[model samples]
Target: MSEIQEEAVLEQDQIIVESGRPKMLGYVFGFFAVTLLGYFLVNRYYMPAPAVNTAPAVRFAPSELLNDLNKRLAYLQNRTTGVSFYIHTIRKKENLWKLASKRHYSVHAIIGCNPQFETYDVSIGQKIIIPSRAGTLHPVQKNDSWQKIASRYKTTLPELVKYNNTALDIGYGDLVFVPDRRPDMALMNDKLREKYELRALFVSPLGGRLSSTFGRRKHPVTGQYKLHGGIDIAVKTGTWVGAAADGVVTLASDGVGHYGKAVFVDHQDGYVTHYGHLSKILVRPGQKVKARQLIARSGSTGRSTGPHLHFTIKKNDVSKDPLKFIW
Candidate 1:
């Protein structure tokens, strides 16, 4: 039997024993209704409600953390610190010479604008501050070699060693300054402006194409292949030639063995320069010269077929590439 029916029967039985006088049907129904009502009230008041679920849990990713750390490190690495200053613009084709010639500016000041130019050519519309003079030429604390010093200055080891009269392999802990100046390039610039007024370095070597380089060649006149000491830029007779650097003219004589009307210059920095094969010597020996100053006119004065500028640079009596010192 169902619980509610059984409970009702039990109630009737109890009523009969008490006084068989009562009709108990209604009483049993009332008891069942009361039990149901009490049960509902107890369940509602005593039981806990269910928890409502929301979003999913997130996982910790190591790679993502690493990427964030790297970004922060890069930011720190790129951060700069120093006193800053303003630099003026340098126009196209402008150089230290032009800068030195300016009454209001200086070549050292031009050194400050280095980082602003992308190439050897300084451009317009660029902004930069002239850098501080470079680290006292070279340091003194360590026994520095030529190679090390050259590397520190954006120069070559050979150039530094040659200028210092030192060997290729200089020892360490032997500190040496190798004696340097701005090469006085600024002075050359100023002088060139004052005298020549030509806004260039080399004057016409010849009116002809370069037959060969300064290293070696079969001489056009002799034909016995020998080490050609200088460049042979071919031109017809009577072409003009000029000095490549400022100095004092030393030799402007001769239709001798190889060099015809030759001119020599003592540039005074342990360097002597030469220009040969001229039709005419305009400046005599011992005359002061500026870069591009007219020294002679080109000709086949030397044992040469065509006129040309036979240019050479010597340091401590050894020949070298003249291009390294040009402007």
Candidate 2:
């Protein structure tokens, strides 16, 4: 060999000698001959390997864990979040807490979803979002307590306090969030608005002119003095009946008598109103009714010849002339 080739070979031998590692190696048939032989023998049934005592892996899905947590913590979450309806959009690098603060939601609610983070620092494309009410504020009223506020907004008091930081203040007029109650309130509000083109304050069920006054009149059927408890409207027989106020219908009976088909609505204000001697009763007992909801078609039935509603206003269970309450 030449002198350079001889020197290169000598250097390689020296490195192998000092490091004792095979950096430049041909194909190695077995890394460890003894272990390889033993493994081969066991697989071929020459020798049986010792059994390994290993526990089965615990298997669970992230969604299942979240579901379990949600099921157990539903009440707590509800207490913090309240009933709501919202519109939300996902944005970059926004965290649940920050989004919640900006749009107003519970941090606990944000954590409930268990959002994902791509990097230690939030990324530009990272998405964080939540569902909540938008631009709806409850106008504060005098003597409004937390419970009253909650009732007005259709939310629990605890949720109002938590979401709006209301518990921090014991004084009156503390700002509180009105949870946009999911499912019903929004639609109901739409219905109310659609039905009443004018503002809700002026459209009273008793707003019509008192066409026919109540009490002793020359009876169209009987010429005798009979106690006329209900007022008669001068409208036609097909005139629609309206609810006097927000109430639950206690009874809707059609049995023919002095009071033929009758409707009794129990207003929560410790009073009830009765529409008697009608041809039709549309509502059933125990049905919750909104103000101005259609309850019956007016017609003359039983102990009457004219088509008019024998409307009576009862306060504290005592029947009073309907004219005193209605217009």
Candidate 3:
């Protein structure tokens, strides 16, 4: 081979080597750029997001939620009614009397709502059913008149008619809602005595001194502590017993236990007077009697130690001190 040919071949080899090296470097850089871009896109759009540190959401049972709603609805309904019924958790040193006084309710009103609680048997931490208003439910009897029913509940005819929105003549088996009707205290103190001057404030059941007062006492026969439901007026047997107030006879019989030959008169305004220990009952059930009218004869009847008349005054089935009401 000639020298010139050898030089040309060497120069060609150098050129090829230099050019191939540059192209190879460009290819490598392009592949690296594409790989880096692909990685960035996958992280931005395709990969799952990072976890966040937070508490799990709380869930409630469907039944529990429904019950809560129902309780709230019931409470609202009770408020809508004239009387609101609620559950009261008894507090320390709390009693029914204090509760009643604080709530402006009578002791008997509390008893009427909570029939399970005795006069002195309530204790602390007891759950009691409380009523916002005082009253009772009365079922109308056959041949019942509005005047008679209003007098029976101690409410006025207008109030009775308006509350029930019924006619003066009510039918049999009708339900009557009677609200607690009481004379205005301020007016009663001023006008009651003058208005009813002809009628005695209250007539004694029998002509005798009081033997025992109403309150807690030891039973004479049982020797156990008990609540004396009435006042005892000691008298001779066969003494006439007069009605304490004008009222209709609710019960007149010997059917009452511990009080034989008894008579019950229901006066207007939720007032009821009971005469017990009678030898003879002169009145029959449903008969109307005026105040001071003769209704029975006193005697030593069931659970009595001597001849006397047991007199009791009640408001809406709750007993009251007779002395507070009678003159």
Candidate 4:
């Protein structure tokens, strides 16, 4: 009876051990499968995807890029019309003076447009806005005619009208945009040449014959060889002395050495004229005179032998031959 019981118990124990090992193996496999499934779900649905590069690899040179940008900007500027504004970026070695001169604008005009610039001092890379054209704003006054206004501003009537987009008759207190109206060198030279060609038709400064020429000659009073800087015209005493050209009187006094009662007229076009040996000065400094206008009376004064008018012409402060211009 004891041997049969022992053998049965040993077989039952071995069977139980084998069955428990199989269950443990199943549980381990199930746990591994669950973890793998969880990782795949999270990666596919919840986690962010890896970044992908999409930009091109090519690069551009700085100069080429700048040139391209400038070309585009120029094209845009040219296409703009009417009253427009310009944004200027200050460059190296640039200042208000250089900018105004290059653009043919006055420093005041540049300052007017850019009031934000507290001072004339400007720095590179600073941005400023200005008008494309150069000019100033003028207020119309009573009794102001287009011709008078144009003449005052040194511009043509047509240009004034066009720029202001106004009628020929402007009202009092109306504002007008007056552009720089002075003619260029070429046009001025042409006008001067034409005027000299018709000198006979134009009024002469004095109705007298040429007494002395401009050059090196023996001085009449000094009795020495010296340079005669001007032409001498012998006219009767008290003869009316007329202006040779339209200009402003810059000097009208007797203090000028060797030229008593001298009168200097500035044509405002780089040309100036001097009339000396006058007895009476009819104009004052800053007085505007017209061509053929009365300026003084002739007399023998300031190292002169007789009553005569010594006339001199200057261009850009350099003395030039009066004969070449007197005709």
Count clashes in each candidate, considering only residues at least 3 apart in sequence or on different chains.
6, 1, 1, 0
lDDT of 4 by residue, 1-327 (tens): 599899999888777677898876887799999999987765434423222223322223323322343432332233222334567899999977678778777665665444233445679998765566676445456798766777776656555544544422356644455665322222123444344353433245877888998899999998999888889999898999999989899999986788888999998568889999999999999999999899999998788899999998888988766866664
* Pick by TM-score: 1 or 2, better one: 1
Task: For candidate 2, write residues 1-327 as lDDT tens digits.
Answer: 999999999997887677644642421434466678987664443322222324332223433322343332332233223434332344565654466577575443333232222211234554332445432334334687666766665656445554543323223322234554322223133433332222232123433234555576666667777666667665567678888778899989887467788888888657787876666778899999887898887777767667767777777987665533432
User: Could you tell me the lDDT of residue 7 within candidate 3?
Assistant: 97
**Could you tell me which 10 consecutive residues in candidate 2 have the lowest summed lDDT?**
112-121
lDDT of 2 at 156: 61
lDDT of each: 0.52, 0.54, 0.66, 0.67
Maximum-lDDT candidate: 4
Better candidate number, 1 or 4, judged by TM-score: 4
- State the lDDT of candidate 1 residue by residue for 1-327, as single tens digits: 999999999997886677643546667788999999987765434322222223222222323312343332222122211212234466776665465545344443443223122223345655433323221123222455444566555555434432332322233212222223232222133433332232233444334566656677676666778777766667767777777777898787876457777889887556787777777889887799987787788777767666666777787888865543443
TM-score of each: 0.38, 0.36, 0.40, 0.40
Write the candidate numbers in order of decreasing lDDT: 4, 3, 2, 1
RMSD of each: 33.1, 25.0, 31.5, 32.0
| Native-to-model Cα distance after best TM-score fit, residue 75 in candidate 4, in Å | 60
